[model samples]
Target chain A: GAGVSQTPSNKVTEKGKYVELRCDPISGHTALYWYRQSLGQGPEFLIYFQGTGAADDSGLPNDRFFAVRPEGSVSTLKIQRTERGDSAVYLCASSLELAGGGNTQYFGPGTRLTVL
Target chain B: AQSVSQHNHHVILSEAASLELGCNYSYGGTVNLFWYVQYPGQHLQLLLKYFSGDPLVKGIKGFEAEFIKSKFSFNLRKPSVQWSDTAEYFCAVSGYSGAGSYQLTFGKGTKLSVIP
Candidate 1:
């Protein structure tokens, strides 16, 4: 893809429901990241991937939030037993270079999740 | 934990007025700094970045930012503001330790509304 693409731009789920968000990164990019943004706030880091392995998952708030980039091109963020407090926009980004260096991270349109 | 701080939560200015948004970060080692902008109904986009070059780095839309290591600041500026410049700006930083340890820490964005 020419740019990062996210699926189901808006999602409304009931509390305790499980939801999955997907991201398709640009071709040949080696780094992928996930972030969460609450209203009137900046995006908060959730996870990062270099190739197929998750380089960092320290940002995941708890055991309920998980992400995977198995193919190194597409990634999925899964929230198990979602809570109303989890209502926010989930953003995905990708960079051409791997982690540990300075590189531009291109952002996606983001998935707005509304936990009702 | 590393963190970024944006001083102004909101700023309003008339067209052609000078604009500045303050950003500061706290980290113990070398860091990479960046500024990103998000317009209404649009995704986040890069404004400028400061890795290891000149203290002042120019970016798209006639915006520039100065990285002051002593103060741990990466303040963004524009000589004159335009209505098109109305957007939310964010400051982000990443630690430059080693591979798989890179992640961005972002500040709460500053909402800039430039009236024409």
Candidate 2:
């Protein structure tokens, strides 16, 4: 039983560069979510996908942040022109069905992105 | 403008001590509550959750949470804690928007340190 997993456990990039973080959800999970965690803070919602379409993207801070889950099982969070403030741990989670009150989300060991 | 609050920022206790972590959320309508634990280098794991039915919900590893609708709180408790329970605890809430999509809003986690 493989849990949700993220690629590049740690990534260091320049302030003005672009970065793409990938996530592989647990087998059979139909819903995926992206979140960001800053130092001393809890995770903040970024985006959510149900199947192949994004059900909610309101949590995304700005247009510079975009995510896609074309295949419904894997997702990628792309950041354009990264900033120092964007340095944080990017987390991914997935559930067996569309996220509601009862479904439990399984998280991945987040990918820590450091902008220098 | 939904928000979750964790009253304690850090808690240190000895093994076998009773543990309780406070969580309160502010939202206008029906909500789903969850408690997640993150060990030193591991991913976030679901400790417990409360949806509709019983106010008292039990989760894995002897953890439990009680949801009080009137108080807008979902507090996590464990009668006796072990050193292994030391980790960061997060409280999250998701409002039922009726659109079939719910995004989690998490609190500024509480770091628990259990000494053996």
Candidate 3:
């Protein structure tokens, strides 16, 4: 079975520009999450979606970061006014619903974003 | 809020050497723990996870982790590591949250280098 995948494996944009990174979760997965990993740091949570609605986005550093998951399968992370600090690997993951019990999350290859 | 700590930033060892990586997490509520590995130019992949039951959990590639609730630790270990085991390892923890059930808190990560 196909695993989680990300598009535009590498993206470069100028400062103050806007960028959108896309993610496709595994089939039948109902929970999606977005994380950002900076140099020398672990991946930080950005947002989480359960089904079509965003359950939490508290990890977003500022107003410039936003993400959406439509139809519960595809998710897009949008960054506005991109800054050099925003350059990092964006990771996406998915897992089965959490209501019943714990489930392992499957991670995508991640999209590397560079802000010049 | 929750956080994870990896004691070592980098570790180097020869092939067939024993390997151990320490991880500690801080969360007041029930928690789930995970260890993820990322190879060179590859995405993060799950190595193991502990939700409940026995504290000792075994995973793929001859990896295993012991979850100690009192000490709040989940340590990864391998009796004999190969060169192919060289990679970055991450410790993550998920706890109950009103925003969502599984938003993860990750550690800075430990990079392991296995000499051939």
Candidate 4:
């Protein structure tokens, strides 16, 4: 079985541009999450989806960040008006959505976004 | 709000030396604790987790952690570390919030530099 994967391993964009990061979770995982990691810092939670709906999105920094998983398989994280402060590695993770199940997330190779 | 603390931001150790990385979390109600690791250029991988029962948990690569509820601590330990073990370690906590959602809150991360 393939692990979780993200596309466009590296992306460079100018400030105020828009970028989208894609994540393909493992087959049958019903839970997906996004996170951001800055240099010398740990990953910060961004948002989470359970099935086709976002169950938790409070971690999203602002309205400029949005994500969708319409078919309940793949997820895309979209960032609008990217700022230099937005430069960081974006990470995606997934896990089974079992009731009372302790979520053990499996991560994908992050997309390093550089806002110049 | 939930939070995690990694007491050591960076630690240096020699090969075969005993290793311990401290972690503490603050959250109310039921919780899940996790230790994740990232090798150079690699995605984050689960080292172990503690949800319920058995305070002592063992994970891959000769790693283990003891969960002490009273102290709100889950510390990672390895008796003999290899140079390959040099990497970053993260401690995270997850608990249910309102709206039937849960999000992982992570610490600042600990960078372990193992010298061979």
Candidate 5:
């Protein structure tokens, strides 16, 4: 089976521009999550989706950052007025189901977003 | 309100040497613990997890972690290491929110270098 995958392995954009990152989770996975990893740091949670609805979005830094999983399979993270501070690796993960405390998330090769 | 801590930022060891990476978390409720590894230029991979029952959990590549509830710790260990083990190891914790959702909090990763 194909693992989780992300498009545009690398993206370079000017500050204040709009950017969108895509993610394709594994087949049959109903829980999807988004994270951001900065240099020399661990991944920071951004958002999580259960089915077609976002279960928890408290991790989102601000209103400029939004994500959607319209069909409950693929997800897209959108950033409006991107800032240089937003430059980091965007990661996506998915799991078989939301099992309270036992679900194991499989991650994708992150999309490195560079904001100049 | 939830946070994870990785005591070691970097470690160097030789082949056949024992390995230990310290991890501690601060959360008031029941939590799930995990260890993830990311090789250079590779996606993050799950090494192990602890949900319940046994405190000691084993993972792939001869890795293991012991969950100590009283100490609020889940430390990763291996009897011997190989050159291939050089990578970044992350400690993450997900708390059961009682609302059917789990959000992960990751620590600053530890970079392990194994000399051949």
Candidate 6:
């Protein structure tokens, strides 16, 4: 793909329900990241992966949030017992590598998750 | 913990007016800085980034940012603003680790309303 892509552009789920958001990174991108953005706020880091391993997951809010990049290409973010506070836009981004040589991250359209 | 701060939460300007958005970060080690923009109903896009060398970096749409290492600041500026520049601007900083784990920390964001 030319750019990162996410599934379920909009999701409205009841509180306490389980939900999963998916991300498909750009082709040949070796690094993938997940972020969360609330209304009127900027995006916050969630998780980062290099290849198939999660290089950094410290940004996860709590145990209720988990993300996995099994094949280093497609990733899934799972939330257990979602709460109203979880309502926000989930963004996904990918870069060629994280070597710091000006690896520009291309972002997806984002999945707007609304917990009702 | 490293954090990014944006001075203004909201700003209003007329077309052709000069624009400036303040960004500051707190990090002791080497880091990369970036600016991202989000138009209404659109995804986040890269405005500019600073990795090393030049303190002043130019970006698309006549936007530029200056990275001041001593002050830990990377401020975005535009000589002339246009109505199309009305959007949310975010300042981000990514910590550099040897393991290639790059996680970006973003400010709360500043909304710019450019009146035509």
- Model 2, span A1-116: residue lDDT tens: 99998999999999999999999999998888899999999999888888999888888999999999988889999999999999999999998774456678899999999999
Model 6 residue runs over 4 Å out of place are B97-100
Poorest 10 consecutive residues of model 4 chain A by lDDT?
A95-104
lDDT (Cα, 0-100) at B16 in candidate 5: 97
Cα-based lDDT at residue A29, candidate 4: 93
Query: What does candidate 5's lDDT look like per residue over B49-108, in tens digits?
Result: 999889999999999999999999999999999999999999999987544567678999
Clashes within 3 Å, all models in order: 0, 0, 0, 0, 0, 0
In model 6 chain A, where is the ten-residue run with the lowest total lDDT?
A: A96-105
Q: What DockQ was computed for model 1?
A: 0.73
Candidate 1 or 6, higher lDDT?
Answer: 1
lDDT of 6 by residue, B1-116 (tens): 67999999999999999999999999878888999999998889999999988899999999999998889899999999999999999999887754456778899999999999
Candidate 6, lDDT over the whole model: 0.91
**What is the TM-score of each predicted model, taking all chains together?**
0.96, 0.96, 0.97, 0.97, 0.97, 0.95
Candidate whose lDDT is highest? 5
**Tens-digit per-residue lDDT, B9-79, candidate 4:** 99999999999999999998888999999999899999999999999999999999999999999999999
Please give the distance, in angstroms, between residue A71's alpha carbon in candidate 4 and its true position after superposition: 0.8
Put down candidate 1 lDDT per residue, B57-110, tens digits, no spaces: 999999999999899899999999999999999999988535475677899999
By lDDT, is 1 or 4 better? 4
Model 1 accuracy (lDDT, Cα): 0.91
Candidate 5 RMSD to the correct structure: 1.1
Q: Which is the winner by DockQ between candidate 2 and candidate 5?
A: 5
Clashing residue pairs in candidate 6 are none
Question: Interface root-mean-square deviation for each candidate?
Answer: 1.6, 1.4, 1.2, 1.4, 1.3, 1.7
RMSD of every candidate to native, in Å, equals 1.4, 1.4, 1.0, 1.0, 1.1, 1.4
Place model 6 in a CAPRI quality band: medium
lDDT of 5 by residue, A1-116 (tens): 99999998999999999999999999999999999999999999899999999988888999999999999999999999999999999999999774556899999999999999
| Model 1 chain A weakest lDDT span, ten residues long | A95-104
The TM-score of chain B in candidate 3 is 0.98
